[model samples]
Target chain A: MSIDTDDPTVAAAPDPEPDNSLGGIFRAYLAKLRGGEVGSLPAVLGLIALVVVFSSLRPEQFTNSFNFANLIGQSAGVTVLAMGLVFVLLLGEIDLSAGFAGGTCAGVLGVFLTRQEWPLIPALLAALLTGALIGLLIGLLVARLGIPSFVVTLAAFLGLQGVLLTMIGEGGTIPIRNDFINGLNNANLPVWLGWALGLLCIVGYAASTYITDARRRAKNLTVQPLLLWALKTGLLTVVVVAVVGYLSVERSRNPALTSLKGVPVSLVVIVGLLILLTFTLTRTAWGRHVYAVGGNAEAARRAGINVFRVRLSCFILCSTMAAVAGIMIASRTNSVNPNTGGETTLLYAVGAAVIGGTSLFGGKGRVIDAVIGGTVVAVIDNGMGLLDQPQGTVWMVTGLVLLVAASVDALSRRRASATGHV
Target chain B: MSPLLELHGVEKSFGAVQVLRGVDLSVQAGRVTALVGDNGAGKSTLVKGMAGIHLFDAGDYLFEGEPVKVTNPKDAAALGIEVVYQDLALCDNLDVVHNMFLGREMKRLRLVDEDTMEQRARETLDGLSVRTLKSVRTPVASLSGGQRQTVAIARAVLWNSKLVILDEPTAALGVAQTEQVLRLVRRLADRGLGVLLISHNLNDVFEVADDIAVLYLGGMVGQIDAASTTRERVVQAITTGVVPEGGAA
Candidate 1:
């Protein structure tokens, strides 16, 4: 009954508790995988496999720095959209209208910026406001009116597409001539600045980890071994170094004319968002309420959480992120058309989330999961194009990849339940 | 000494059906009061009324000899009354510490204070002499039925509650687990907290209860002393809504 006093005899005796050393942590991780808490393992392994396969098939083209940078720009929109979807899916809800919702917001941006001749910031704000308003309406219907989210968002999907078409006129496109907006996807940081930022990321990650471990240790709580922490930091360091190194090299077709070097601005934006969203989801009380509601709405309500407010907020954040994604896509293409966020865009975003190991069934996901899954989606599309494959082939392969990811999610969920870890 | 909680002539009805009719109950501190009855005996309705989930149509609800109004769950909570329902409301995805401090998490700088929460949770569990849990960080999904019940009970008393009400806490547990939970329930009373335990199991009622309050047809049969009453007499009261002549009341 007394937890404070340590018995000298017991202290002298062999410790019988489970090990908390580095090796023990590794074993525990393996056991978790076996128990079907596979998490991001499958996605990481698949990404590696795809990179190896594509590099072997198109040795010169796929391994080049130019294509590496292209991949980041291509994945930016889907990654941003998937990040939003992660929040919605965490509540066992879907936002089918997110894609067209993005398009509609982009159309608003086009009308404000190109037609009305407004400045960048105001037009951007107007676009984001449009996104928030759409989310508010959808959230109202889903949370307050008690309509099924699937039905509400599905209706919104069709309605938003029509709204976009009407704003831009049927088959019309608005060319974006704004340099700052275009620079989002096409520009790069200076090589020196890129290195500085990359190093800063590594330092920041290490500092945060050290501070958390120190606090936990100060409280006499169970803390992972220092070796495990070092290993994780080392891994992140390697990744950032590799990406920054690759991007720092001159990848321009004509190095004498223009230097296409340093990390893409879109990549920096995405990483910033990833850090912010990850912090929000892991550290904040509102984030915990989200997971609680996702896990068991009844339990959350009984615990005095406003389940409806959590539901409404998630939808609002999802659509706002979608609006950001729409802006990025428009930046990449230098224009806003009815098709800006139409066709395979929403599917790719959802697929990215699922493929990154975010569960379709609520209560399991992270912001980083969407980023990893988005990269996997981008690689498939990029690789298929390099292979000179038909558009049909690319879509089929992407579809099959999504299907397999979903099957893995379902099977792992079943395994988790069987092992009493559900 | 006055009872920690006393309900006098409590009446409740839903539409045309009157679920409870002039029921009386008293729970004393440092004692276990077992409320027993058969199906549709209005045990749940009575407890819900006291919990403010359903306000009694008419009654004198007194706490520490003071008349109080409990119109909602928040009011009941403010009065230091906590209810652990039969279903044991807990989020499986959250760990024991998180579940214990679910909606009422301690925050520092607008972020959940994880270190403080973990420390408090460990201290609370230790104070209850809970040694079955190896770590407070284990997810509720991975815990056994008995452990989950323990967590629920621990959560009920976390807020320095004056009275704790549990509905069928052992109904879904095994014999060994049932014994574990009953011992914990008794330990709660030993800590000078009033405990109102609603159960159908006679063995449980007789094992830890100091007072036995029988409900029949939405009416109180009698609140009898457990040590002086026979099981047959209590059973008779439940079945016929009348106390036997020789029964201690």
Candidate 2:
């Protein structure tokens, strides 16, 4: 791959490849993983180990379909909130106020819906707008005033908790009566609908991959072998279909409860969000700019990127996603209170992002890291509770897992840099 | 031919300390002009003025014989002038294509057209005969110093720059990498783009520069055709601000 001539156009093309077969691809992937391309591997492995250990300890409680569904529902709020934090974390910034900001947004929605008796859309809109404005204020302080994000968000954390307290008032809770909001956690899709949704996702993913591959081939670029693509798609399909089938099984012993066995609406919401956000963070130019800014703000500025604008947008997006998480939390509990979104909620969100593989050092992460990390946390919580462990035990296990995840991240990053693969 | 960029009596100061004082310099298309100076001789300040990072307080800044006021980097960029800073100004976390088209991405249907951008990046690198890179998708951090320098130069060239300024292009590079970069600079000039190279290494300055401009004590000492002068004369000019046999300033 050396250019020997002064005239580059006259240089001969380099050797192509030893193999373009399935075995070659597999070996390459193995080598890559060894070379520190271990994105989400630790989380996935942790998830498997949790399943094995928990099933051995409490098969009836942990392996039940109902409990699995509950785990997904429990993870929804943290997962969504963590998704927002992914953006901030990508820039190596922290939002200590994520939970409180979300709590305040939910409080706004609750007050408008119950006290003022407002329409649902307007109430939700007002909550989202309030979240955006909060983010804008924090972003302005960070970007315009040049305060470090950690300080600005820490102040917001305290201030927004106060806002939540005032909204709910002393020793009070607003019980949400809205059918749609409350049903977000309580309801489930029909079995057929759940299967159809899973099918849709699989088909959509495969189609996009095929189109990309075709485009690459047409351009005379290196394309992954069709067999390898099929293997990947087949593996994904099996996992998705298996999850759907498992969820579709009837969980209730009572003969009256016939339709409550499918995927929870909350799971669907989180998945939908996961898809939307993954697209935004991967396919869009805005997403690229976010990474660039997070990677090197000075370099980004030199490239003429409006660093202020990028940082502000990240804050706005994070707060807006946090607002959505707040709505989900309120929906699940049917109430908004002073205690909502406090007491380890923000810690879980940040932990979820970090444990899922998003770097605290910025510029290296994906939106899906939140999902993996959130699921891991939820499984630990669910499994520990099934083993008759106390909340403190669960906390310790979660903390240990978070520490392991961080060590994995740090080690992998160092290896990557050392190997010059970066 | 007339110089592509001409700076006449450019002056700048930070507070009371003047960094550039009435510096006159010109860069011709299809030629490499090396700007040599000592540590405090204001080479950086002069280059910054041309880059539009620090607008000259007093000067006739001309582009193609037309006087213009360049107050910012954007103004310089608008006139097809690109500066590859010594630090390279590359986000190490980003891949080569992203770094090449960082802020000004070629979008199709409002989305970053990665395919098109990748194609253009490949063409740009190929045009400059840079064949050492394994892939355009490789992150900047993985590249060797010489490859990184090439990426920086390729980025400057990709933007259709008429005058490309490189500051200390070979300072941190190994001997082989330095040779590769000097050749690339020669190729850039061969492509008819005006090149301003800033360096402390006179050996490099002599190897590739067509004309050499010496800066001493925040002022231009002389601008001499490189082949007509020797390293001792250039060193004397850089250190003493005078050519032994009366070179033109």
Candidate 3:
């Protein structure tokens, strides 16, 4: 028969029946890890190296409990901004104006809070709405009018800077008086509340991961081994508990205000955003659609996805995240000024995302990239500050790290394309 | 068997250009109807018309003998008509499971049900007797041309479609890969789909097609049974749009 069942090419080699057992899964994972399919490993390793080097060089300063807490605390603004950038970057797009657009959002809120004397909730909403409106305009221009995102956002970058300047006025500063808003970065959760929150996170993570893995196994689908899953869950539990434990230790030298020391408010906010975004990007059909659109727009369209809507939603999300990051920045500094969320802010956000291993060409990235990438940038800045490095030295070193990251991205992409593997 | 899909006297135009004129075509259930033509012979236009990318200006589109109107791809999809374009329509960055269930993802609790979707994707590939893939989790970009084509075909059938129109399925494949895909085409028909196989490869057409329809300059020469026709006559119709008076098409 021309259609022979034994045609070698037609049937190909039966892939070694997948070893679905724990040992087999472990072996497979090891293989992938060796192949550099282990996402975020590089960033984590870099972060660890930075922590060790900095602590050894300036143990008294870098290893201080206050510094450790402050490192995470100060990362909130750029971390959130980078999280937003990850969305756009995954779509193989860029938001050049994200930093200043965030600034504009903060300025709007600051003006309302300090100058217009608006209520906090209403002011907050207006500020967020302004961010969304800017994003909507950018989305329409990019998705509907077919303008390249680079051009549109570059225009936004300059235009939003102007808007921020106008709102705060030239060489002016607007001090945020709302205690609730101002406390966002500086406040710490009560020690008991911090432990409770950590426990909640561990439980939630364990339950969701276990339920989903169990469901997949029940359906006889490919699943990670139980041992591996348990190992991962255990590691997460340890990390969260340790973080809460560390944060709960009093860093205050002041005898009276020592009770105020606990997990910084920004840590909770950052973690919350991380979980929310990770779920959205991984577990939702809309997230899959965004990936498909980024991978191949025509294929997505042929598959009956509304490509325009996906693109628009992605831009809106990027902008909305920037708005949140802006608010965090305002909270941290207790004021909004012309220089807030300027060039370095956007630069660092993009750097953090890319350095943390988010692909510049989209369709492949994770929210966790921002978390890791943000830490790397913050540590570098923090380390240099302790060393009393000149401003030029800090810029030069950050630029170098970003270039290396870009090179890694380009190199890995080339290798992947050459090997025809993800 | 009656034709599952029939287009009667279909006409299409682009400004002053008439791309398809009074073309009549029919495809039966559980059969492969080969659509062949020279370059610029309106083969794509005819397929696009049926795919709902471009609607025929003047035609009666009949499904199971009932006239229907398909204004867009979504409408055609709703009617169980799927077209696998020449590009294969698979996202390179997505894994096989993801690509298989791109837009129509299975959901549980308003979230994508990855387990069910993966199982279904595996089952669909198994049903097609495709064993080349090491895992369904492999990205489409990592797949060979033939495997990608298989993925596209599997995706079309995964939706439980009644009719599948393939445009140049083997055009970019190698000799071995082409044979693999041709075998896959037969398997799809064996599964009882109404298959419209558009191709330029005469050997491929002869190997799998149950019926042959040749197009010449915006007009269909005729639809003839593949088993009863010779290559020379089919070529003659393709090149000149006319079979010798004594020869059967």
Candidate 4:
């Protein structure tokens, strides 16, 4: 109403002269829908391009369904731990101990279940508790002592490494013989179950997003355009379909052994954890406080948010998730030993998170970003492995990708602040 | 009338720089008390001390005509006092409703009660006459400066706030938005809130303030009714320690 008369400048020249061309308007809408996604477009496309390059380079091996399954199975533990690492990263903190912490948990679980004859469920709980306790210790040192997270966690990493070494007993190993634990690593869900689950998850996620968007829109919310929403749901559907399709086929060819089954249990567990973490981060008061602490500690403090508790909880969650990853890794390999923690695995987890576009400067990341980032890291590792790249080369390339992602995060942060968009 | 909040001989020093030197302030219910001073005139210090952000080194704070202690922000909040600092601390990623209930949320069955919070937040914002909000769910990042200020003010008010201290509330808003917020301030006073408005914008001060207490270099220069005092006199007291041509504390 005011546009017609109150602003003389807007009224003076206003004959609507095809203000937005169809193509321009369409393109603008595309750009808008791609809001934060724009910063990560390069990496997303890179994942695709890498797949193409790897498949062509080793068409016989890389393009095989078996190899693809192998890649997913192999990276499962890393990705799980990476997801947890993302939470710590979100607070602009580092958890150097996640790798060994998880490994220590594996040893703890191995001792409890395989040797002590504890049930797999209780044993796993004990392992998770162990991880959470480690995280709590780290959190206590950092929050109460006011020591930096990096320094504190670094010490925790070294200390946990020693503790793991001690637990496993001088390069000794625990052979996990539990049928249930082995089934989680070796077996898969039925193809129909996988497809049904995949479709259900995709539909559920999309519907939830749409419903939330509509609910907000009813409140006259400023929603991203419908096209953007469509694009997201569409892309999500494609990814789920592709993954389920790939997982449905037989990837094994041994006469005695079973043919490939379904998505690994770890993958299912990862998804469940992602959903839970996402809810905790986005929907809960505690999650909001984490963002608050990250965004402005002083401000959050003034708002009466218990900043220390938020930070401590993030660390606690990170390590607890790490413990879950450890349980998976121990089950997959059937042992906990000197190499249980794995070398540079924790660094890779951080690399995955940093590559996924989480800000090192904090207060500006999503759990989904970490999930996306974990997949990105997995894609690179898988692609490089298909090319028969050396372990050194894999680490080097991962480091480069991490650097690029960090740069992208920093640049995008600047752009967001400048445009006042974030 | 007796003061509802009193700061007697408050002093703040950072190293060798003493920002507030034996500053005295008195605030009462249902009135807008303006803290007027030049830049670096210890106005912020006095405000912080009053809001519990800073503890005065040598001051006795009297609340409701009795001496009280405020160790931190939580203590101040528990007493129904709120300070809207200059930066506001409004989360850019949060919406109006979320920002209003950021830390202190309505809980039911041990979970954040969405319905109760949303309804209350909507009411608080509506009461402020902030109709231009795009949505209560829109991230505060998209809000105009005035809208963001409205969110901060709403957050402060929604907490059952009694003594609302607004630090430079109209500093960056447009003329009309300033008028809107000033009116909101007036309504708050009418609700029997003790409002301590710290503003350099004398026009804004004159519009909403009931009594303008000038702070000049860590001292209580003078307290004058907005109805009786002229802008020239306030400005003079603000610039110099002495009140304009025959004013006194």
Q: Score the docking of each candidate (DockQ).
A: 0.50, 0.48, 0.51, 0.28
- Model 4 per-residue lDDT tens digits across residues B1-249: 888788887878888888777777788898888888898888888877777778888888888887889988778888888988878898775667778888887777766666567778877876766555534665566556666777888889997888999999989878767777788888888888899999988888888888888877767787887787788888888887777754443
Show the lowest summed lDDT stretch of 10 residues, model 3 chain A. A5-14
Per-residue lDDT over A1-422 for candidate 4, one digit per residue giving the tens place of the 0 to 100 score: 11222112111111233224446456654643333324446567767777788878888887777777666666667778888887787777889989999999999999999789898789989999999999999998887788999998888888888998888899689999987777666668888888988999988988988986687557643444556677788988998998889878787878258667677666777788788888777777787788778777777777778888988988999999899888778878888886676686787777777776677777767666666677777777878876778988987888888887877777766655554421
CAPRI grade of model 1: medium
Question: How well does candidate 3 match the true structure in TM-score terms?
Answer: 0.95
Considering the two chains of model 3, state its CAPRI-style docking category: medium
- Top DockQ prediction, candidate number: 3
Q: Per-residue lDDT for B137 in model 4?
A: 65
Residue-by-residue lDDT tens digits, candidate 3, A123-189: 9999899888888999999999999999999999999999899888999999998999989988999
Q: Over the stretch A38-83, how does candidate 2's per-residue lDDT look in tens digits? A: 8898999999999999999998889989898989888888999999
Let me know the DockQ for model 4: 0.28
Per-model TM-score versus the true fold: 0.97, 0.96, 0.95, 0.85
Candidate number 4, chain A TM-score: 0.90
Model 2: lDDT to the true structure:
0.88
* Model 4 misplacement above 4 A: A1-40, A115-117, A206-234, A254-257, B1-31, B38-42, B53-72, B93-96, B108-123, B131-147, B170-194, B201-208, B216-219, B244-249
Off by over 4 Å in 2: A1-15, B246-249
Candidate numbers, best TM-score first, in rank order: 1, 2, 3, 4
Model 1 per-residue lDDT tens digits across residues A107-148:
899899999999999999999999998998999999999999
- Candidate 3: residue A287 lDDT (0-100): 93
| Residue A369 displacement (Å), model 2 | 0.4
